[model samples]
Target: MAHRKVGFGLRGIGHAVVNGVGRLGYASRFFLMILIGSGASFRRIHLTIREIYFTGVMSLIIILVSGLFVGMVLGLQGYETLQKYGSESALGSLVALSLVRELGPVLAALLFASRAGSAITAEIGLMKATEQIAAMEMMAVDPISRVVAPRFWAGVTSMPLLAAMFSAVGVFGGYLVGVVFIGVDVGSFWSQMEAAVDFRQDIVNGVIKSVVFGIAVTAIALFEGYDAPPTAEGVSHATTRTVVTSALVVLGLDFILTVFMFRGV
Candidate 1:
Protein backbone atom coordinates (compact mmCIF):
# COMPACT_ATOMS: atom_id res chain seq x y z
CA MET A 1 0.00 0.00 0.00
CA ALA A 2 2.87 2.42 0.84
CA HIS A 3 4.60 1.63 -2.42
CA ARG A 4 1.39 2.26 -4.36
CA LYS A 5 0.85 5.53 -2.51
CA VAL A 6 4.38 6.66 -3.38
CA GLY A 7 3.80 5.95 -7.04
CA PHE A 8 0.56 7.93 -6.99
CA GLY A 9 2.31 10.84 -5.34
CA LEU A 10 5.06 10.80 -7.94
CA ARG A 11 2.51 10.70 -10.72
CA GLY A 12 0.66 13.65 -9.23
CA ILE A 13 3.87 15.64 -8.99
CA GLY A 14 4.74 14.92 -12.59
CA HIS A 15 1.27 15.89 -13.73
CA ALA A 16 1.52 19.19 -11.86
CA VAL A 17 4.87 19.98 -13.38
CA VAL A 18 3.59 19.29 -16.86
CA ASN A 19 0.45 21.28 -16.24
CA GLY A 20 2.45 24.31 -15.10
CA VAL A 21 4.71 24.13 -18.11
CA GLY A 22 1.76 23.88 -20.48
CA ARG A 23 0.15 26.93 -18.89
CA LEU A 24 3.38 28.88 -19.21
CA GLY A 25 3.63 27.96 -22.85
CA TYR A 26 0.08 29.05 -23.54
CA ALA A 27 0.64 32.37 -21.76
CA SER A 28 3.78 32.97 -23.82
CA ARG A 29 1.89 32.46 -27.06
CA PHE A 30 -0.81 34.83 -25.87
CA PHE A 31 1.82 37.46 -25.12
CA LEU A 32 3.06 37.21 -28.69
CA MET A 33 -0.47 37.60 -29.97
CA ILE A 34 -0.85 40.75 -27.95
CA LEU A 35 2.40 42.04 -29.36
CA ILE A 36 1.33 41.34 -32.94
CA GLY A 37 -2.09 42.85 -32.36
CA SER A 38 -0.54 45.92 -30.73
CA GLY A 39 -0.08 47.54 -34.13
CA ALA A 40 -3.67 48.77 -34.04
CA SER A 41 -3.03 50.65 -30.82
CA PHE A 42 -0.08 52.46 -32.34
CA ARG A 43 -1.78 53.11 -35.65
CA ARG A 44 -4.98 54.43 -34.13
CA ILE A 45 -3.34 56.04 -31.05
CA HIS A 46 -6.73 57.21 -29.74
CA LEU A 47 -7.59 53.80 -28.42
CA THR A 48 -4.33 53.65 -26.49
CA ILE A 49 -4.90 57.19 -25.24
CA ARG A 50 -8.28 56.22 -23.87
CA GLU A 51 -6.78 53.28 -22.06
CA ILE A 52 -4.12 55.58 -20.60
CA TYR A 53 -6.81 57.80 -19.23
CA PHE A 54 -8.28 54.89 -17.32
CA THR A 55 -5.12 53.08 -16.21
CA GLY A 56 -2.89 56.09 -15.70
CA VAL A 57 -4.87 59.25 -15.01
CA MET A 58 -7.47 57.54 -12.86
CA SER A 59 -4.68 56.03 -10.77
CA LEU A 60 -2.72 59.23 -10.09
CA ILE A 61 -4.35 60.31 -6.82
CA ILE A 62 -3.64 57.04 -5.06
CA ILE A 63 -0.09 56.98 -6.37
CA LEU A 64 0.57 60.52 -5.24
CA VAL A 65 -0.79 60.02 -1.72
CA SER A 66 1.01 56.74 -1.22
CA GLY A 67 4.32 58.15 -2.37
CA LEU A 68 4.11 61.09 0.00
CA PHE A 69 3.30 59.00 3.06
CA VAL A 70 5.97 56.43 2.23
CA GLY A 71 8.60 59.11 1.88
CA MET A 72 7.68 60.72 5.16
CA VAL A 73 7.92 57.40 6.97
CA LEU A 74 11.25 56.63 5.36
CA GLY A 75 12.66 60.02 6.26
CA LEU A 76 11.61 59.62 9.87
CA GLN A 77 12.90 56.07 10.23
CA GLY A 78 16.08 56.72 8.27
CA TYR A 79 16.81 59.86 10.22
CA GLU A 80 16.43 58.03 13.51
CA THR A 81 18.70 55.23 12.41
CA LEU A 82 21.37 57.52 11.02
CA GLN A 83 21.23 59.70 14.09
CA LYS A 84 22.27 56.77 16.25
CA TYR A 85 25.47 56.58 14.24
CA GLY A 86 25.87 60.37 14.11
CA SER A 87 25.31 60.28 10.35
CA GLU A 88 22.11 62.26 10.18
CA SER A 89 23.30 64.20 7.15
CA ALA A 90 23.38 60.93 5.22
CA LEU A 91 19.61 60.68 5.69
CA GLY A 92 19.05 62.20 2.30
CA SER A 93 21.21 59.60 0.61
CA LEU A 94 19.45 56.87 2.53
CA VAL A 95 15.99 58.12 1.64
CA ALA A 96 16.78 58.89 -1.98
CA LEU A 97 18.62 55.63 -2.57
CA SER A 98 15.89 53.64 -0.87
CA LEU A 99 13.20 55.17 -3.03
CA VAL A 100 14.93 55.30 -6.42
CA ARG A 101 16.80 52.02 -6.26
CA GLU A 102 14.22 49.72 -4.75
CA LEU A 103 11.19 50.96 -2.88
CA GLY A 104 10.08 53.40 -5.56
CA PRO A 105 9.93 50.82 -8.33
CA VAL A 106 8.71 47.94 -6.21
CA LEU A 107 6.05 49.80 -4.25
CA ALA A 108 4.83 51.70 -7.29
CA ALA A 109 4.50 48.47 -9.21
CA LEU A 110 2.62 46.81 -6.38
CA LEU A 111 0.19 49.69 -6.21
CA PHE A 112 -0.23 49.63 -9.96
CA ALA A 113 -0.89 45.92 -9.88
CA SER A 114 -3.56 46.19 -7.21
CA ARG A 115 -5.23 49.21 -8.77
CA ALA A 116 -4.84 49.21 -12.54
CA GLY A 117 -3.95 45.57 -13.09
CA SER A 118 -7.04 44.28 -11.30
CA ALA A 119 -9.22 46.69 -13.24
CA ILE A 120 -7.85 45.49 -16.57
CA THR A 121 -8.47 41.88 -15.74
CA ALA A 122 -11.99 42.57 -14.49
CA GLU A 123 -12.89 44.67 -17.53
CA ILE A 124 -11.63 42.15 -20.07
CA GLY A 125 -13.08 39.24 -18.16
CA LEU A 126 -16.45 41.00 -18.02
CA MET A 127 -16.35 41.59 -21.73
CA LYS A 128 -15.74 37.91 -22.20
CA ALA A 129 -18.46 36.93 -19.76
CA THR A 130 -20.97 39.23 -21.41
CA GLU A 131 -20.11 37.89 -24.90
CA GLN A 132 -18.78 41.24 -26.05
CA ILE A 133 -15.47 39.76 -27.16
CA ALA A 134 -17.38 37.05 -29.02
CA ALA A 135 -19.63 39.60 -30.64
CA MET A 136 -16.52 41.39 -31.92
CA GLU A 137 -15.20 38.10 -33.23
CA MET A 138 -18.47 37.39 -35.02
CA MET A 139 -18.34 40.78 -36.60
CA ALA A 140 -14.93 39.96 -38.10
CA VAL A 141 -13.23 42.40 -35.79
CA ASP A 142 -9.99 41.23 -34.23
CA PRO A 143 -10.91 41.70 -30.60
CA ILE A 144 -7.32 41.47 -29.45
CA SER A 145 -6.22 44.17 -31.83
CA ARG A 146 -9.12 46.35 -30.85
CA VAL A 147 -9.50 45.58 -27.16
CA VAL A 148 -6.45 44.04 -25.52
CA ALA A 149 -3.60 45.69 -27.38
CA PRO A 150 -4.50 49.24 -26.50
CA ARG A 151 -4.65 48.47 -22.77
CA PHE A 152 -1.38 46.57 -22.98
CA TRP A 153 0.41 49.47 -24.63
CA ALA A 154 -1.18 51.97 -22.30
CA GLY A 155 0.01 50.03 -19.24
CA VAL A 156 3.51 49.78 -20.64
CA THR A 157 3.60 53.53 -21.25
CA SER A 158 2.11 54.58 -17.92
CA MET A 159 4.19 52.49 -15.53
CA PRO A 160 7.44 54.38 -16.01
CA LEU A 161 5.78 57.73 -15.58
CA LEU A 162 3.99 56.61 -12.42
CA ALA A 163 7.18 55.22 -10.96
CA ALA A 164 8.98 58.46 -11.70
CA MET A 165 6.29 60.49 -10.06
CA PHE A 166 6.32 58.24 -7.02
CA SER A 167 10.05 58.59 -6.60
CA ALA A 168 9.94 62.35 -7.14
CA VAL A 169 7.19 62.91 -4.59
CA GLY A 170 8.88 60.58 -2.14
CA VAL A 171 12.05 62.63 -2.36
CA PHE A 172 10.16 65.81 -1.66
CA GLY A 173 8.47 64.22 1.33
CA GLY A 174 11.77 63.05 2.69
CA TYR A 175 13.15 66.57 2.31
CA LEU A 176 10.20 67.94 4.23
CA VAL A 177 10.65 65.57 7.15
CA GLY A 178 14.44 65.65 7.28
CA VAL A 179 15.04 69.33 6.53
CA VAL A 180 11.97 71.15 7.74
CA PHE A 181 10.89 68.97 10.63
CA ILE A 182 14.12 67.44 11.87
CA GLY A 183 16.37 70.34 10.89
CA VAL A 184 18.97 68.35 9.04
CA ASP A 185 21.51 70.43 7.14
CA VAL A 186 19.97 71.14 3.71
CA GLY A 187 23.27 71.40 1.86
CA SER A 188 24.62 68.17 3.28
CA PHE A 189 21.40 66.34 2.56
CA TRP A 190 21.29 67.21 -1.16
CA SER A 191 25.06 66.96 -1.60
CA GLN A 192 25.30 63.53 -0.03
CA MET A 193 22.44 62.28 -2.18
CA GLU A 194 24.03 63.71 -5.32
CA ALA A 195 27.35 62.11 -4.54
CA ALA A 196 25.90 58.69 -3.72
CA VAL A 197 23.29 58.24 -6.46
CA ASP A 198 24.73 57.31 -9.84
CA PHE A 199 22.53 58.31 -12.75
CA ARG A 200 23.22 55.32 -14.96
CA GLN A 201 23.43 52.68 -12.27
CA ASP A 202 20.61 53.75 -9.97
CA ILE A 203 18.18 55.96 -11.88
CA VAL A 204 18.29 54.15 -15.20
CA ASN A 205 18.07 50.77 -13.56
CA GLY A 206 15.01 51.90 -11.59
CA VAL A 207 13.35 53.01 -14.82
CA ILE A 208 14.18 49.67 -16.41
CA LYS A 209 12.68 47.86 -13.45
CA SER A 210 9.49 49.90 -13.74
CA VAL A 211 9.18 49.09 -17.44
CA VAL A 212 9.77 45.38 -17.00
CA PHE A 213 7.35 45.28 -14.08
CA GLY A 214 4.79 47.07 -16.22
CA ILE A 215 5.11 44.47 -18.95
CA ALA A 216 4.88 41.57 -16.55
CA VAL A 217 1.91 42.90 -14.63
CA THR A 218 -0.03 44.00 -17.70
CA ALA A 219 0.62 40.76 -19.56
CA ILE A 220 -0.48 38.63 -16.64
CA ALA A 221 -3.62 40.69 -16.15
CA LEU A 222 -4.59 40.52 -19.82
CA PHE A 223 -3.84 36.83 -20.02
CA GLU A 224 -5.88 35.98 -16.95
CA GLY A 225 -8.81 37.90 -18.36
CA TYR A 226 -8.55 36.29 -21.79
CA ASP A 227 -8.23 32.85 -20.26
CA ALA A 228 -11.01 33.29 -17.70
CA PRO A 229 -14.08 31.07 -17.91
CA PRO A 230 -17.03 33.00 -19.28
CA THR A 231 -18.86 33.47 -15.99
CA ALA A 232 -19.29 36.12 -13.32
CA GLU A 233 -17.43 33.97 -10.79
CA GLY A 234 -14.63 33.42 -13.27
CA VAL A 235 -14.23 37.13 -13.80
CA SER A 236 -14.07 37.80 -10.09
CA HIS A 237 -11.49 35.10 -9.50
CA ALA A 238 -9.41 36.38 -12.40
CA THR A 239 -9.42 39.87 -10.93
CA THR A 240 -8.19 38.52 -7.61
CA ARG A 241 -5.55 36.47 -9.37
CA THR A 242 -4.36 39.52 -11.26
CA VAL A 243 -3.42 41.34 -8.06
CA VAL A 244 -1.94 38.32 -6.30
CA THR A 245 0.03 37.12 -9.29
CA SER A 246 1.28 40.59 -10.11
CA ALA A 247 2.55 41.07 -6.53
CA LEU A 248 4.42 37.78 -6.47
CA VAL A 249 5.90 38.37 -9.91
CA VAL A 250 6.96 41.89 -9.02
CA LEU A 251 8.79 40.78 -5.89
CA GLY A 252 10.48 37.87 -7.63
CA LEU A 253 11.55 40.02 -10.54
CA ASP A 254 12.81 42.70 -8.20
CA PHE A 255 15.11 40.25 -6.45
CA ILE A 256 16.41 38.85 -9.74
CA LEU A 257 16.95 42.29 -11.28
CA THR A 258 18.61 43.62 -8.15
CA VAL A 259 21.11 40.82 -8.14
CA PHE A 260 21.97 41.36 -11.78
CA MET A 261 21.98 45.16 -11.68
CA PHE A 262 23.62 45.76 -8.32
CA ARG A 263 25.94 42.78 -8.01
CA GLY A 264 29.66 43.64 -7.81
CA VAL A 265 28.84 47.31 -7.43
Candidate 2:
Protein backbone atom coordinates (compact mmCIF):
# COMPACT_ATOMS: atom_id res chain seq x y z
CA MET A 1 0.00 0.00 0.00
CA ALA A 2 2.83 2.40 0.87
CA HIS A 3 4.62 1.68 -2.42
CA ARG A 4 1.44 2.20 -4.40
CA LYS A 5 0.82 5.55 -2.66
CA VAL A 6 4.36 6.70 -3.46
CA GLY A 7 3.96 5.72 -7.11
CA PHE A 8 0.66 7.59 -7.33
CA GLY A 9 2.12 10.73 -5.74
CA LEU A 10 5.06 10.72 -8.13
CA ARG A 11 2.74 10.24 -11.09
CA GLY A 12 0.61 13.16 -9.92
CA ILE A 13 3.68 15.38 -9.65
CA GLY A 14 4.79 14.43 -13.14
CA HIS A 15 1.38 15.01 -14.55
CA ALA A 16 1.17 18.45 -12.93
CA VAL A 17 4.59 19.43 -14.25
CA VAL A 18 3.64 18.35 -17.77
CA ASN A 19 0.40 20.25 -17.63
CA GLY A 20 2.08 23.36 -16.32
CA VAL A 21 4.61 23.29 -19.16
CA GLY A 22 1.87 22.77 -21.74
CA ARG A 23 -0.11 25.71 -20.42
CA LEU A 24 3.01 27.84 -20.45
CA GLY A 25 3.65 26.90 -24.06
CA TYR A 26 0.11 27.79 -25.02
CA ALA A 27 0.37 31.15 -23.21
CA SER A 28 3.61 31.92 -25.01
CA ARG A 29 1.99 31.27 -28.36
CA PHE A 30 -0.97 33.41 -27.37
CA PHE A 31 1.33 36.25 -26.38
CA LEU A 32 3.09 35.97 -29.72
CA MET A 33 -0.19 36.18 -31.55
CA ILE A 34 -1.15 39.31 -29.64
CA LEU A 35 2.15 40.92 -30.57
CA ILE A 36 1.64 39.98 -34.20
CA GLY A 37 -1.86 41.40 -34.27
CA SER A 38 -1.00 44.50 -32.20
CA GLY A 39 -0.64 46.58 -35.34
CA ALA A 40 -4.39 46.73 -35.70
CA SER A 41 -4.75 48.39 -32.31
CA PHE A 42 -2.28 51.08 -33.28
CA ARG A 43 -3.88 51.57 -36.68
CA ARG A 44 -7.29 52.23 -35.15
CA ILE A 45 -5.88 53.85 -31.96
CA HIS A 46 -9.39 54.53 -30.63
CA LEU A 47 -9.84 50.93 -29.53
CA THR A 48 -6.64 51.10 -27.53
CA ILE A 49 -7.75 54.42 -26.05
CA ARG A 50 -11.09 52.93 -25.03
CA GLU A 51 -9.36 50.08 -23.26
CA ILE A 52 -7.07 52.54 -21.51
CA TYR A 53 -10.15 54.29 -20.20
CA PHE A 54 -11.48 51.03 -18.84
CA THR A 55 -8.27 49.63 -17.36
CA GLY A 56 -6.20 52.69 -16.45
CA VAL A 57 -8.54 55.61 -15.91
CA MET A 58 -11.02 53.53 -13.95
CA SER A 59 -8.24 52.37 -11.61
CA LEU A 60 -7.01 55.88 -10.66
CA ILE A 61 -9.00 56.31 -7.45
CA ILE A 62 -7.66 53.16 -5.82
CA ILE A 63 -4.12 53.71 -6.99
CA LEU A 64 -3.98 57.32 -5.85
CA VAL A 65 -5.52 56.58 -2.46
CA SER A 66 -3.27 53.61 -1.86
CA GLY A 67 -0.18 55.53 -2.89
CA LEU A 68 -1.00 58.33 -0.52
CA PHE A 69 -1.51 55.98 2.42
CA VAL A 70 1.59 53.99 1.67
CA GLY A 71 3.64 57.16 1.50
CA MET A 72 2.28 58.46 4.79
CA VAL A 73 3.15 55.19 6.48
CA LEU A 74 6.62 55.23 5.01
CA GLY A 75 7.16 58.77 6.18
CA LEU A 76 6.14 57.89 9.70
CA GLN A 77 8.27 54.76 9.86
CA GLY A 78 11.27 56.31 8.19
CA TYR A 79 11.15 59.39 10.36
CA GLU A 80 11.01 57.26 13.51
CA THR A 81 14.04 55.23 12.46
CA LEU A 82 16.08 58.17 11.21
CA GLN A 83 15.44 60.28 14.30
CA LYS A 84 17.01 57.58 16.42
CA TYR A 85 20.19 57.86 14.35
CA GLY A 86 20.10 61.72 14.27
CA SER A 87 19.72 61.59 10.49
CA GLU A 88 16.24 63.03 10.25
CA SER A 89 17.25 65.29 7.39
CA ALA A 90 17.77 62.22 5.29
CA LEU A 91 14.05 61.44 5.44
CA GLY A 92 13.49 62.75 1.93
CA SER A 93 16.06 60.44 0.43
CA LEU A 94 14.63 57.52 2.31
CA VAL A 95 11.04 58.03 1.18
CA ALA A 96 11.92 58.99 -2.38
CA LEU A 97 14.30 56.08 -2.86
CA SER A 98 11.86 53.59 -1.35
CA LEU A 99 9.03 54.68 -3.65
CA VAL A 100 10.96 55.21 -6.87
CA ARG A 101 13.17 52.15 -6.48
CA GLU A 102 10.67 49.58 -5.30
CA LEU A 103 7.35 50.44 -3.70
CA GLY A 104 5.75 52.44 -6.50
CA PRO A 105 6.16 49.94 -9.31
CA VAL A 106 5.50 46.85 -7.21
CA LEU A 107 2.46 48.06 -5.32
CA ALA A 108 0.97 49.63 -8.43
CA ALA A 109 1.39 46.42 -10.38
CA LEU A 110 -0.24 44.35 -7.65
CA LEU A 111 -3.17 46.73 -7.54
CA PHE A 112 -3.46 46.66 -11.30
CA ALA A 113 -3.54 42.88 -11.24
CA SER A 114 -6.27 42.77 -8.65
CA ARG A 115 -8.42 45.43 -10.26
CA ALA A 116 -7.96 45.63 -14.02
CA GLY A 117 -6.45 42.23 -14.62
CA SER A 118 -9.33 40.41 -12.98
CA ALA A 119 -11.80 42.54 -14.90
CA ILE A 120 -10.11 41.72 -18.21
CA THR A 121 -10.21 38.03 -17.37
CA ALA A 122 -13.87 38.14 -16.47
CA GLU A 123 -14.81 40.15 -19.55
CA ILE A 124 -13.07 37.89 -22.01
CA GLY A 125 -14.24 34.77 -20.23
CA LEU A 126 -17.84 35.95 -20.41
CA MET A 127 -17.46 36.81 -24.07
CA LYS A 128 -16.20 33.29 -24.67
CA ALA A 129 -19.07 31.81 -22.69
CA THR A 130 -21.53 33.82 -24.77
CA GLU A 131 -19.84 32.70 -27.99
CA GLN A 132 -18.95 36.28 -28.97
CA ILE A 133 -15.44 35.22 -29.87
CA ALA A 134 -16.82 32.42 -32.02
CA ALA A 135 -19.23 34.75 -33.77
CA MET A 136 -16.32 37.04 -34.56
CA GLU A 137 -14.43 34.09 -35.97
CA MET A 138 -17.40 33.20 -38.17
CA MET A 139 -17.63 36.79 -39.35
CA ALA A 140 -13.86 36.89 -40.05
CA VAL A 141 -13.53 39.85 -37.70
CA ASP A 142 -10.32 38.60 -36.03
CA PRO A 143 -11.29 38.79 -32.37
CA ILE A 144 -7.71 39.00 -31.19
CA SER A 145 -7.15 42.17 -33.19
CA ARG A 146 -10.55 43.62 -32.46
CA VAL A 147 -10.71 42.67 -28.83
CA VAL A 148 -7.53 41.37 -27.16
CA ALA A 149 -4.80 43.38 -28.81
CA PRO A 150 -6.23 46.75 -27.82
CA ARG A 151 -6.48 45.70 -24.19
CA PHE A 152 -2.96 44.30 -24.14
CA TRP A 153 -1.51 47.46 -25.63
CA ALA A 154 -3.53 49.67 -23.31
CA GLY A 155 -2.18 47.82 -20.29
CA VAL A 156 1.40 48.09 -21.50
CA THR A 157 0.98 51.83 -22.03
CA SER A 158 -0.94 52.57 -18.84
CA MET A 159 1.23 50.72 -16.35
CA PRO A 160 4.21 53.03 -16.49
CA LEU A 161 2.01 56.12 -16.28
CA LEU A 162 0.12 54.75 -13.30
CA ALA A 163 3.36 53.89 -11.54
CA ALA A 164 4.70 57.37 -12.14
CA MET A 165 1.54 58.91 -10.75
CA PHE A 166 1.74 56.66 -7.72
CA SER A 167 5.33 57.65 -7.05
CA ALA A 168 4.63 61.32 -7.54
CA VAL A 169 1.62 61.28 -5.24
CA GLY A 170 3.56 59.25 -2.72
CA VAL A 171 6.24 61.89 -2.68
CA PHE A 172 3.60 64.51 -1.95
CA GLY A 173 2.15 62.45 0.87
CA GLY A 174 5.57 61.99 2.37
CA TYR A 175 6.16 65.70 2.10
CA LEU A 176 2.86 66.49 3.79
CA VAL A 177 3.66 64.23 6.73
CA GLY A 178 7.38 64.84 7.09
CA VAL A 179 7.38 68.57 6.42
CA VAL A 180 3.92 69.77 7.41
CA PHE A 181 2.76 67.47 10.17
CA ILE A 182 6.07 66.32 11.67
CA GLY A 183 7.84 69.70 11.22
CA VAL A 184 10.80 68.44 9.27
CA ASP A 185 12.80 71.04 7.31
CA VAL A 186 11.46 71.42 3.77
CA GLY A 187 14.79 72.48 2.27
CA SER A 188 16.69 69.48 3.61
CA PHE A 189 13.93 67.09 2.53
CA TRP A 190 13.81 68.25 -1.09
CA SER A 191 17.58 68.71 -1.34
CA GLN A 192 18.45 65.29 0.01
CA MET A 193 15.88 63.66 -2.28
CA GLU A 194 17.21 65.53 -5.28
CA ALA A 195 20.74 64.47 -4.47
CA ALA A 196 19.96 60.79 -3.91
CA VAL A 197 17.26 59.92 -6.42
CA ASP A 198 19.03 59.77 -9.78
CA PHE A 199 16.94 60.11 -12.93
CA ARG A 200 18.62 57.38 -14.93
CA GLN A 201 19.25 54.93 -12.11
CA ASP A 202 16.09 55.04 -10.05
CA ILE A 203 13.32 56.63 -12.16
CA VAL A 204 14.08 54.88 -15.43
CA ASN A 205 14.55 51.52 -13.77
CA GLY A 206 11.20 51.90 -12.01
CA VAL A 207 9.53 52.66 -15.33
CA ILE A 208 11.12 49.61 -16.89
CA LYS A 209 9.89 47.45 -14.02
CA SER A 210 6.36 48.84 -14.38
CA VAL A 211 6.33 48.11 -18.11
CA VAL A 212 7.52 44.56 -17.60
CA PHE A 213 4.91 44.02 -14.91
CA GLY A 214 2.21 45.45 -17.16
CA ILE A 215 3.04 42.99 -19.91
CA ALA A 216 3.09 40.08 -17.47
CA VAL A 217 -0.16 41.00 -15.73
CA THR A 218 -2.11 41.77 -18.89
CA ALA A 219 -0.82 38.75 -20.77
CA ILE A 220 -1.71 36.43 -17.91
CA ALA A 221 -5.16 37.97 -17.60
CA LEU A 222 -5.82 37.68 -21.31
CA PHE A 223 -4.62 34.10 -21.54
CA GLU A 224 -6.66 32.96 -18.53
CA GLY A 225 -9.82 34.57 -19.89
CA TYR A 226 -9.26 33.22 -23.40
CA ASP A 227 -8.59 29.74 -22.11
CA ALA A 228 -11.39 29.70 -19.53
CA PRO A 229 -13.98 26.96 -19.81
CA PRO A 230 -17.25 28.28 -21.21
CA THR A 231 -19.09 28.39 -17.91
CA ALA A 232 -19.71 30.81 -15.07
CA GLU A 233 -17.67 28.72 -12.62
CA GLY A 234 -14.78 28.51 -15.06
CA VAL A 235 -14.77 32.27 -15.65
CA SER A 236 -14.75 32.94 -11.91
CA HIS A 237 -11.90 30.51 -11.38
CA ALA A 238 -9.96 32.02 -14.25
CA THR A 239 -10.38 35.52 -12.80
CA THR A 240 -9.03 34.30 -9.48
CA ARG A 241 -6.09 32.68 -11.20
CA THR A 242 -5.33 35.90 -13.12
CA VAL A 243 -4.87 37.88 -9.91
CA VAL A 244 -2.85 35.15 -8.14
CA THR A 245 -0.58 34.32 -11.05
CA SER A 246 0.04 37.97 -11.92
CA ALA A 247 1.07 38.75 -8.34
CA LEU A 248 3.53 35.88 -8.21
CA VAL A 249 4.99 36.72 -11.59
CA VAL A 250 5.32 40.43 -10.74
CA LEU A 251 7.20 39.78 -7.47
CA GLY A 252 9.51 37.22 -9.07
CA LEU A 253 10.27 39.49 -11.99
CA ASP A 254 10.88 42.45 -9.66
CA PHE A 255 13.53 40.46 -7.80
CA ILE A 256 15.23 39.44 -11.03
CA LEU A 257 15.11 42.99 -12.41
CA THR A 258 16.42 44.47 -9.16
CA VAL A 259 19.36 42.11 -9.25
CA PHE A 260 20.22 43.20 -12.76
CA MET A 261 19.57 46.93 -12.28
CA PHE A 262 20.83 47.59 -8.77
CA ARG A 263 23.49 44.94 -8.38
CA GLY A 264 25.84 46.81 -6.06
CA VAL A 265 23.37 49.22 -4.50
Error of 1 at 143 (Å): 1.0
Per-residue C-alpha lDDT of model 2 across residues 55-106, encoded as one tens digit per residue: 9999999999999999999999999999999999999999999999999999
Candidate 2 TM-score over all chains jointly: 0.98
Number of the predicted model whose TM-score against the real structure is largest? 2
Compared with the true structure, what per-residue lDDT tens digits does model 1 show for residues 1-265?
9999999999999999999999899999999999999999999999999999999998899899999999999999999899999999999999999999998999999999999999999999999999999999999999999999999999999999999999999999999999999999999999999999999999999999999999999999999999889999999999999999999999999999999999988
Instruction: At residue 153, give the lDDT of candidate 2.
Output: 98
**Candidate 1 clashes between residue pairs 3 or more apart in a chain or in different chains:** none
lDDT agreement of model 1 with the native: 0.95
TM-scores of all models? 0.97, 0.98
Error of 2 at 40 (Å): 0.8
Which residue pairs in model 2 clash with each other?
Answer: none
